[model samples]
Target: MGSQSIESGPIPACELMPASILISWHPPTTADVTVETVPPEVVEGENVLLLINSLPKNIVALAWYKGVHNMSHVLALYSLKYDISVTGLAHSGRETMYRNGSLLIQNFTRKDNGFYTLRTINSRGEYVSKTTTHVQVYTTLWMCEHPSISGKLTVESVPPSVAEGASVMLLVHHLPPNLLGFSWYRGVFLSEVREVSRYTMPLNLSMRAPAHSGRETLYSNGSLLLQNVTWKDIGFYTLQTLTTDLKNEVLHVQLEVETSFSTCCNSLTSAPVMIERVPRNVAVGGSILLLVHNAPDLQTFSWYKSMEKIDKFKIAEYSRAMNSMTWGPEQTRRQKVYTNGSMLLQDVTEKDAGFYTLQTLSRDLKIEVTRVQLHVYKPVRNPFIQATSNIVAVQSSVVITCFSQDTGISVHWFFNNQTLQLTKSMKLSPTKCRLTIDPVRREDAGDYQCEASNPISSKKSMPLSLIVLAF
Candidate 1:
């Protein structure tokens, strides 16, 4: 068999070229393959290197010797260098490596995890394999994925309230390579890792709140839990993660709690009222409660247009303990109108008017129920504005799209509110909320709004204002 010139520095073309890389014409009747270790078993802070064959006849693979890692599991890595007889050597993050059937060792790192596996395949079906290596790094290090704690955690360093004298259970989830010991901190300063009577998988720490104590215990898992929590248990706690391979990652834990019998203006107290649109072309109509669950004693029931209640549905009473609400004034006159904090008029005609609001009395505060605008029959979807490029000149195709968060959006192209004549550029693609404008001119730049709705609700997105600037 013949051979080719081997280059140094850059990886040779053979190793990375796939199946063809191992193909050598000279079939091995019998060949000698040797594996050697450069620096052998390593300690921290060291570099190791090794050489393959002297003759070097298409050397296929180089790898590391392996052993048990983390006292569990086996892993193999291959990153062989096939340059100038050097090939098939893998790296474990600048540490131990398997190079060309030779063991190449280096300084130990915390990330030198798992066992090492190296494989080699020659063109003639000859291959070498090495597996089973143990990796030992120093120190326990951990990090929380995304727990932002840059600025102030709480208002100030005011000690958070605790359970006065209850057991304060603190937990920390650790994923350390060489997890050793850990310490706790209150605020940013180092505090002792309180030894609790209970111990869990990660770290379970507990302590009795010192009477009127203004201290919050920080854990290794980057979390803070205040037990027997009180007003004083209000400040911020910091959890610092320590490891041998890296600097500590400090995480902030903010503590907050709402007192019982609290009052809120618009959150949780209100029902979920959402506009469900089909495609701006195909619309469906319906209505949902504005306020979900609030004070049971909903004494005043009112509907308003703008800010004034329509007085259409007389006052109603709701009782949470009673598990029901009473809205009187017979469901008459408006057939499609339902008084459940929201009223939907189906098969909506252009005559359908403006926004309606529902208000109720709860938690001692008179909060409006929900609001909805009765839109006339109109369809709108996503609007597409296409030009030659960002620098759109005259004679550009402008497409307006109409999409309904609700349904049945019959698109009506409007220049302002007045309808525009349907031209070739203003073609209507039925059931689709897409609009197209072509042969654009500076004159075509104006206010264009898409109206999308379903049988249930009608809505409009912010109008698109076309701006054409001459360069």
Candidate 2:
């Protein structure tokens, strides 16, 4: 076999093998096509000077495949490359001066995969091979150091129930070999760092939003460790090896939380209080019901709205027929008898607006202070509308809002007694419900009102007369 010297190029950093590059080629029909290679393993993000040497006259156009096929032969789009003088089938320069083709790749991604088959089809039918390399970038910049389970994982103290407050500490790792750390994210963004030497697992010691709590694990070497075990701690944790793109192993840890310290404080032993839900004011057509929760067992619950005590049997009958019975919620107008535990005011008009009390008779137990609020709203008159400017120019915007006294209601907006369009500028926010006309003109002045409604009844604010100003 005849051959010529090829130029050597620089190497990439993310590649393994330290200093050895893998090169392969096939023989073409002509013996004149002799090929040689210089530097094979080029450092990623660096420039490469590929020297493809061939017989004086056999240098053909350059062809480059950004990525080469591995044993499995999955075509990775990320594994593509570029060549400077790439034409259909022509060479830039020929023969004597070994063509110095500048093979530079930029902004490499994991998909930039690799390069190979740097060939020169020489005149003598014998092709020459320069250098080929397999390139892969770490998907993650960091890894876990002794990644362990978070503490909020619960058990039966319930084999598995997410705890109210707990966090798992994980040691993060950043290395060339442990670059794949997708597990830490679990397809979601993590609040922790990715590639640190150590990290604490997720922990939510605060029980503010318990339902939002979740589980995850940290893994290194072969073991999956868990931390802050709760009854919810009993579950399967998979240790996925990014190098293999599959689950290498799984860990099952069981943990539980016992009945923590008990005290008369916040415990059931405290004389429980009974509080009811009743609006202080109702519109011309509205209703109200009394509700008392967290009541101590057998504590006689009494309902008194405007000084009248409710009857117990009436509440029982109400319960039997209610779509769903709740402390005699079934009591209808026909039953007419209000129960001591519950009382319902139907089709409430302005006359029915007043303070309703849920009197608790832990009278025998008498140790806890129990009280709640009932603010009913009865519109003294139809809502009146107001605006900053009645004749605002077409290009100017205006704000319209509703105001009312304690109607015991969180209102939603309505147009012509139907649901109004909810948009960024026209909808109600937590602090205030407002309506804004992006550009008001003479035509926009009209009747508008805010209706506040709740589970029981609805009320509408007085209509505001709007008058738009035209420029």
Candidate 3:
């Protein structure tokens, strides 16, 4: 045996190549042939290459068998002497053999999976070596329906309503034994449908689509699991199942996700109650709502301006049973309590930026209290940037100040329409309202703007051009 190099031709762009394997041949004694699948496992409709390694010298012919090393199941045969190749009985027109004794299977299907044997023949026309390997074929993405089944396939959620950050499973009911595959979709409409995942029963494999959030799991039983669900997940989900008989079944299930709250116990009663906060940041002269959720069956609920004694700071009160409302000493026409326990505050001012408490008294005399924090900020006015000099030489110092009429507002500087990046030579004042560059470089020359913002609103000034001389 001499040193021989076997190179493969250009593979199709769609084919996925497996890890490279090194092959070396020494003095020819006994043929030590080994066959391996480039990728032992492949998805249906993909190409798979069977690599033959450690070829012995004087190899006259190479033949491939589909299973059990039977001649009837031969896939392809290659004769090195005549430089000819031919397909065998088991050939499904998808198998191709390279001159180097390797085999390529195009559009591999489930029927092509299982044991494949490669047999090497010597110049004497005797089978020198036979190597076998196993290949796994997974199903591809597909959906079909024949509607031959009698009953309807339904999907049910483990819990009808799920809390935020909790996991839920959409279980399939009355699943047929002849199920071929199932797919989960996000929306009800076909035009706007977004596939979550698809599972094939024969392959016992699941494939995720572009809409997968990395929090979903598909089970073989045609169930889908979603973890750490959020408000955005509170919508309708559709499941479509395909059976072996070409029967199709579809079901839709709705999931509701709600925000959770801490439970508080009252000294007067042992019953625990939940309190929810609806924090709001309203601008001056704007209306705001201080909302409450999961309020107990109450006789009356009071909204107070502060957490002080309810009698002194009470803003308004509403009785659920009587369906009537009463104004407190601090309550004005602008402040009103709704029958649902939410309080609406109109024309809010800076003085309203404080904590407000909600005290509820149940019909059984149980008390539950919750607090909400309100922020009343003045709408930020447009800010302008003032520089010591619009034109400066490189390495010169420059001072730029951002000014806004609104107090308690944050100022941000932008360079060329982007957030300014502070260099080592740049410094900001304690309030960050002023920027000073001790040694401005040529790159610093650009348009600059200042933005002033409060919690409620923000405004940006027109661009100010700065020219820096390079020389």
- The segments of candidate 1 whose C-alpha lies over 4 angstroms from its true place after superposition are 1-297, 310-344, 363-370, 379-471
* lDDT value, residue 58 of candidate 3: 66
**Which one wins on TM-score?**
3
TM-scores of all predicted structures: 0.20, 0.25, 0.42
Q: Write the per-residue lDDT of candidate 3 for residues 6-112, one digit (tens) a residue.
A: 22313221121111101112222443554556554356788998877667776777768888535567676666755667666677778888777788999888888
Residue 182 lDDT (model 3)? 85
For residues 1-471, could you state the per-residue lDDT of candidate 1 as single tens digits?
A: 111222222543444334342343223332233222233322345454433332245545432334422212112223334332332223233433333444445565555543443335444434433223233332211111111321222221123222343434444444354433343344333444422111122444443322214444444433344456543333234455555565455444433223321232235444322222122121223222223233344544454444235455443444444556565452333323222333434444443344444565554555544443443433433432221122234664544544333332344556665565556556654443555567666666666665554443444555556654333
**Candidate 2's residue-wise lDDT over 1-471, tens digit each?**
111222212222112111112233454433222222222222334333334333334343333444343312211111112221212111112212223433434443444543433433332323444334333332221111111322222111122223434543332223124323333221111233321122222331112111223343434422223445443332123222233343232112222233232221365554234444445334456666654444534344443342224544223322222323234433445223243345556775554444344454443555332332233444432332334433345556666655433333355556545566644434343424446677555555566677655434556776656655443
Worst 10 residues of 3 by lDDT: 13-22
Off by over 4 Å in 2: 1-381, 414-418, 422-430, 441-446, 453-457, 465-471
**In angstroms, what RMSD does candidate 2 have relative to the true structure?**
29.0
TM-score rank, highest first? 3, 2, 1
